[model samples]
Target: MKMNMFGLFNKKKSDTVSLPYTTDIHSHIIPGIDDGSPDVEHSVALVKQMQEWGVKRIITTPHVTEETFENTPETITAAYNLLKEALGEDAPEIIFSAEYRMDENFLKHVKNDILIPLPGNHILIENSFLQPFWDLKGLIYQLQLKGFNPILAHPERYAYYYDEKEIYTDIYNSGCMFQLNWLSLAGYYGKETRNIAYWLIEKGYVDFLGTDLHNRRHARAITEFLQTKEYRKLVEKLNLKNDTLK
Candidate 1:
């Protein structure tokens, strides 16, 4: 597949260009695996775009819900292989993991081999959009007991926690890392999530930044984000965007 530059490989970005935080351990870029890239061509394109943004490695995380994605290790591996075949040897290092939803049956997945672990012992977790789990703390503790460090993806967007400012700190203190969606900082999830992303970053609570690149829509938000001076400056100033892999 031929690569087109959507400012992906263009490194002559302004001093305002914020580098990526780290390898995106959460994304739906795997074709048909989740709601991300539609097929092989689109997946390859997304990968090229990530490369242009200076992402050295990308762990494509397709969703694995008991009812929805249901992406087992075998299914995800097949998607990885297909993506590689499309990109050829020149493709970036593409790894496979999953974004697992924390549900009533989540504990069973933790016990079974159905769930995939994020790189470096991290487990990407998502909760409901309406309300947080009643046993949220216990669930996280269960994940910890299983020897996996759970990462709460897009913590700011959860509606229930918007009023409770300390929810972020409380969860983080419970041994979970926070992954902020790049679009949230750019107001993609609306003004509330955007403000929360900034708030968390300011408070030194956001450990990682994720593109959460679901599709072309998300791609557009990231493009806009890169053009901003603060976005570029924060990554370098705090050393949060580009230095975590070391």
Candidate 2:
């Protein structure tokens, strides 16, 4: 397996490695709901490829942004059902969830008690790419107050927080868990994100590692990344909670 400058992989299907854990907590596999898989065929293909890489269970998280995705429970479940019907019994166990952007829609869902959580009542939340949300600490408090365990999604991708590394510690200290995008360590997002990922690992702040699998391009990068010496070294020292999801 080989990786290119664009972070895509050139490899055969046989060039695979077992994932560190079976359950992928962050992925966008629900068909047509977001920017992940465009249709059921694509969703099936991604899942099959993931199974080949030894992911036995997947908690597929589609985007739930206000203006962009606007994924309600009804829409998400509909897409999930369609994908499951297409896959039949020849795939990994898949659970439907949402990677919620901390926006008004999310707050509304929280108030209405309409959010879908992971197996352990864990909710994956994302911040805006351009800036951290104005009241992230308040939002985390609200989620916790409502009995939801919040897991911040892909902190390394937030460029605004890069210079203020102490804020990462503050969020973790606020009782919110952190989930690092595994591909970030593979330089899939770029050198800066990869550096932040390693920094989070060194800080003992990353509680989970997720694929955040969007499409085939991401899958290829991750598959090739899993076979690298860097991946082996990183996993050896870090204590990840991915397997505990089941």
Candidate 3:
């Protein structure tokens, strides 16, 4: 296999290196919910793999989009409960949260005060793939006013921002933290995303690193990436905020 930015292959490790964050704050491990794990078996299997990766706790963030997923709190909790029952006591500690795609659905949830915040009252929010939310800043302000720490999910994946990259700093300055996808550094999403990931790290704007693990493919990619030197360097330099959540 060809080694990409993360030293994915063509490199040998002298010793094992684990991620700095023990609790993964972003993932889609709740089965039959969204675009993540498909069923209970897959959910348990993915959690086991996460445990193998040294994740002591996992806060799975399933998608809650309008019309598309429309996953409610009751639905998410039921899926979480099923996974918990399937895993018994051997599974890694798990928590249920939703990846809010700053859309009308999210706005309704926010207004209703039903959005599930991650540790420290942090809300993991993202933009639409093609464009950002028009009232993104205002939404962040509202979230903050309501005592929710707004976390922008996978800013590098927003291709629109590649041209106007200064928006990243603007978002960060607006008091919203950035969550980087681990696959981006591994060149899993392609070189552009990988370069942006490195750039964000170098610029001191990366606040969190999330697996964003949706299935076995993502789990395998992260497993291989962790064996690379770049992974260790990122863990050492980023000073990730996941520890605070624990």
lDDT of 1 by residue, 83-151 (tens): 889889898777877888787456677777466776667788888787787877888898788787788
Pairs that collide, model 2: none
For model 1, the stretches where C-alpha displacement exceeds 4 angstroms are: 1-18, 236-246
TM-score of each: 0.88, 0.94, 0.92
Which regions of candidate 2 deviate over 4 angstroms?
1-14
Count steric clashes of candidate 1.
5
Candidate topping lDDT? 2
Q: What digit string (tens of lDDT, one per residue) describes model 3 on residues 58-109?
A: 9989999988899988999999999999899787889988899999988999
Better of 1 and 3 by TM-score: 3
Question: Model 3, residue 191: what's the lDDT?
Answer: 98
Ordering by lDDT: 2, 3, 1
Best TM-score among the predictions, by candidate number: 2
